[model samples]
Target chain A: MPKIVDHEERRKIIAKATWNVIAREGLGGASVRSIAKEANLSLGAVRHYFQTQEELLEFAMQLVQEQVTERIMEHIQSHLPPKDQVLNILMELIPPEEKKIEMQVWLEYISYKIRKKELQKESVHEVIVEILHRLQKAGLLKEDILLEEEIVLLHALIDGIALHILMGLVPIERGRIRYLLEKELNRIFVE
Target chain B: MPKIVDHEERRKIIAKATWNVIAREGLGGASVRSIAKEANLSLGAVRHYFQTQEELLEFAMQLVQEQVTERIMEHIQSHLPPKDQVLNILMELIPPEEKKIEMQVWLEYISYKIRKKELQKESVHEVIVEILHRLQKAGLLKEDILLEEEIVLLHALIDGIALHILMGLVPIERGRIRYLLEKELNRIFVE
Candidate 1:
């Protein structure tokens, strides 16, 4: 009998390999051949999971967003206080020790998405909007600021922090970035 | 006698080609061979001007920075008023015109420098420090904020705005981004 592969397990393995390729060589290097080599799978086997490079990249990007969301939700659940929940959500976006590579990969993917219009699908916008709504509903966001400007500022703040950390300009302490975020948040939102 | 080539003109041609490649195909595609093709020069001719790809890229990056600095300074000099100078500096960073391509290329180069440690030379740091110092000396920056934090926030603000413009989430209007920048500046600097 032929050997059976657990579909979900295989998907996870491929996604992890995709992240590795992105972290090691950037989004440009996350080609099918490179990812297959990184995953220790044949080209055919990699294609068996992802039909094309775009499909693979889209899946990887989705996985990254989902992973971040999952961690944020989990952290918020553990902390009952809204302030702590907000703090945890910001923390989840920073370079978690074990997930640093994933964060790096996600940054590259987002940069790519910015230049490439086809990549800016509704799903990505939805994810951003959903996060903005959550923060607002939690009353963690400033009510005085327009929701659009606040959303823009929040995204810019996070991206700015991520860029600095990745560039080694700022120390990679979650507390430092979170503190900065809190300061900015307080400037806009009433306590 | 062999024909003489205008060295300065040749250099400008090559640099323009480099920018074109970066705008079209990104930094990864701005290889020596590809740049030569874009310049319509033989590889040997291109090499005659730039000894190596690294040298070529460094010159191109510096040129982009200089162009931006020149524009900002011109606007400052022409405006005479400090508030207008500050507004012009912020407006110069936004996209949706000829400068849009330059901004895109600069973003790519900045992100590229993050992954490549060898590219982080003293000159880059010096340029950043000088810009920060000039802005602070102009009394445009908040006095209470540490200089280091001020520098970081400026970078974040620019990067954030650039990313949003590139992502199409924010409309590329001089008034829109400028208004946002002015608001943030007021919050940070003005009482």
Candidate 2:
């Protein structure tokens, strides 16, 4: 009998391998063969699940969004205070100490979107606006801050911090990202 | 009779072509042939000016820095109020009504640096710090904002706005960018 392969587990392994490849060599350097090699699997096995490189890349990008959403959902379900939950969601984008690879891989995917000229992915924008709206409902947003502008500013702030940290332009410590997120949110929200 | 090409004028033409190509097709698509076509020049004519793609790209990036420097120097020579001069320098990076191509190309170059793992560009950071220090000397920076953190934050804010504007993540109008820059400067500077 042929060895049994856990399909779901295999997809997880491939997704992780894709992240490693992107983090190390960038999106351009990733290929089915490279991902397979990174995952220690045969190319055929990797391709059996994903028909094309674009498909695999889409999967990887979705995984990045999913991971971020899952983490944020965990915080939301914990019923943290509105400000704390909002800050937690924003801070999650700035990967933790051990999760730098995820941020690198996410950036690679973001770059890929530009390279491919596929800028239609608005899920992140929607998720951010949703959280900000929740904060507004909770009376956390400052009355003077326009809701739409605040949402855009929050998204831009989070993206800027994530990019700068990934590029190593700033030598900020891990927890400092959270602190900055808290500080910026505090500046925008009701005292 | 053979055509006479002014070498300096020819370089300027090629640089503009390079910017157009990058803004339209991104860096990966900006090959010599494409740039030559965009410039309405023979490939040989373009190659005579720049020996390699890397050289052309380097020239394009250096031109970005030089243009910003020239504009800022003009302001520095104006002997305006320090806060006004600082805002002028910061706003230069955002481009005017005419030089939007330059900002797009600059962002492309910045992205190239990250993808190539050559993230050693520090001129932009230095320029921001230099201006902010001028503000601080003029007794302009907000009393509570940490100087070092302010530098990094300003850098991130400017970069994030440029990236967003270029990527169409925000439909921020050109004048509105100046307004936003001024508002951000006011927030950082004295009341």
Which is the leading candidate under DockQ?
1
Ten residues in sequence with the least summed lDDT for candidate 2 chain A: A107-116
True contacts kept of 1: 0.34
What are the per-model numbers of colliding residue pairs?
Answer: 1, 1
TM-score of 1: 0.82
Interface root mean square deviation of every model, in Å?
2.9, 2.9
DockQ of candidate 1, scored on C-alphas against the true complex (2 decimals): 0.43
- Give each model a TM-score: 0.82, 0.86
Which lDDT tens digits does candidate 2 get at residues A1-191?
Answer: 99998888888888999887866655556789899999999989889867676687777877777888899789888877777777777777767657767766665555556545677755566788788887788787778877766665667777776677656677666576678777778788787
Off by over 4 Å in 2: A49-53, A115-117, B1-3, B49-53, B96-101, B142-144, B172-177
The digit string of per-residue lDDT tens for model 2 on B6-78 reads 9888888888898878766666567889988999999998888676656777877777778789988998999
* Residue clash pairs of candidate 2: B140-B190
Mark the 10 consecutive residues where model 2 chain B has the least summed lDDT: B163-172
DockQ of each: 0.43, 0.41
Best candidate according to TM-score: 2
